[model samples]
Target: MQGWRSSMEDVHCTLLKLDDKAWSQWSYFSIFDGHNGLDTARKCAEDFHRYLLKSFNEMLKHGEPIDGPLKSSQLDLILFRKTIKQTYFFMDEQLRKSKTQHDESGAVVITCLIGPEVIYFMNVGDARAILVSKTGQVLLSTHDHKTSDPDEQHRIAEKGGSIWDNRVEGQLAMTRVLGDFSMDKDLVPPDADIKEYTIHDTNNPLGFIVLACDGIWDVMSNKECAKFIVERMSRTQDLCKICDEVLEECLKRGSADNMTIYIIKFL
Candidate 1:
């Protein structure tokens, strides 16, 4: 899913799978919440998977053992964190080499890497990643990266950055993303800085993931959505439809920004 209001700004969502070499296993799902502009979002969406694969292979070459006893879920999280770190370095170096500065473009990422026995999930920034249990309970939910997080403020200051405050006195926005090069200068130890999360054994009889940008979440509660999907599934089990319904509801609630959602059901 790639949704944009203007040609320059974009929001992207993606899904892919890594089939086990033995042809017996695989993993899938992804999303990119593009901000400032869609160009970065599009570039990241197109290159994220490839970059991660390359980064993983590089890790293997660097003597990071791939053959380990840890479940693939855990290993994937480690690899993902490593990949994000590598990508950050690669971007930083590329920008520096090109003398690029003052580019206010970036993206947030959320993903569910379905492994052999668990779902390794990760969220960076504002998008939501929810896990529903078989008994109709929310097992987990990703929180927004607002001014509430201290690390965000510290990084912003470390980068010698400042945010706009329309309220005359209050200004708040979390510090993290894909392309905001101005703030990139502050993220020392880049690899260790990217946000990551993991969930184990998510093979419930009726468990799934619903990921969407703030456009939808701004109006609907997590439980409101879970209930909508759970109750509606009795007649039709279309995740995309659920996503569309959420978008419509957001519009009804006066959201003017571009909206995109990706829903995944695990049974």
Candidate 2:
């Protein structure tokens, strides 16, 4: 839970202990990186968690069990995925209808929900999340949505958009994001890549989950970040100090963009 901003355009939220009575065991964390301004990022930090909780509650009302058991059926898993997707859309729609004008600004978002038996994540734009094993292996990581990606390029072209200088319409660098009303809605949709992982060996432990904006990723590889944490944890158990060291490392590596990193250790 440490962040360093080269500018004031980055925002983050952390719920080390979420207070939802229905899902008391869950915790939430997220990072929002604003491109043109900080309005969208600030708004997301303030409201996105509420939207996610609301979506989860709606699914619970429909008989989707999300608590008290470690085992989840296939149907329950599907319903959870749907709830996350709907929450992303719901947040974006709210941003669109906001009283503040955000035609030129937008944000990249990465959010994670940690439950007793599973960890769920949703990512949009270039921000990323990674799961590292105890042995310093990268088990999973989210992909960045950039114009240079073939799938993103194809989608943009299909929506009557062009990429030049590796930017959408030669302006925005990311292919997917929230807000940015100036970009074509179809080209820059608010769709997020949702994923979940079951925590199987809680006794032996899984490792760590690292959520960060592109600023850190641009300078450090996934393995490097994980190894850094592992080395620090071996000596001291100060997670906050480890995160601060990571931020300093990024700055030493000359990361010019606003930087944020959130680490969740499973051990």
Best by TM-score: 2
Model 1 gets an lDDT of 0.58
Sequence-dependent TM-score of model 2: 0.91
TM-score of each: 0.75, 0.91
Error of 1 at 24 (Å): 7.7
User: 106-183, model 2: which lDDT tens digit per residue?
Assistant: 999999888877788789999999998888888889989988799999988888999999889888889889888887
CA error at residue 61 for candidate 1, angstroms: 4.0
- In the range 1-39, model 1's lDDT, one tens digit per residue, is 223356424445444445243112435456666666565
Each model's lDDT: 0.58, 0.83
Clashes of 2: 0
Give the CA lDDT, 0 to 100, for residue 82 in model 1. Answer: 66
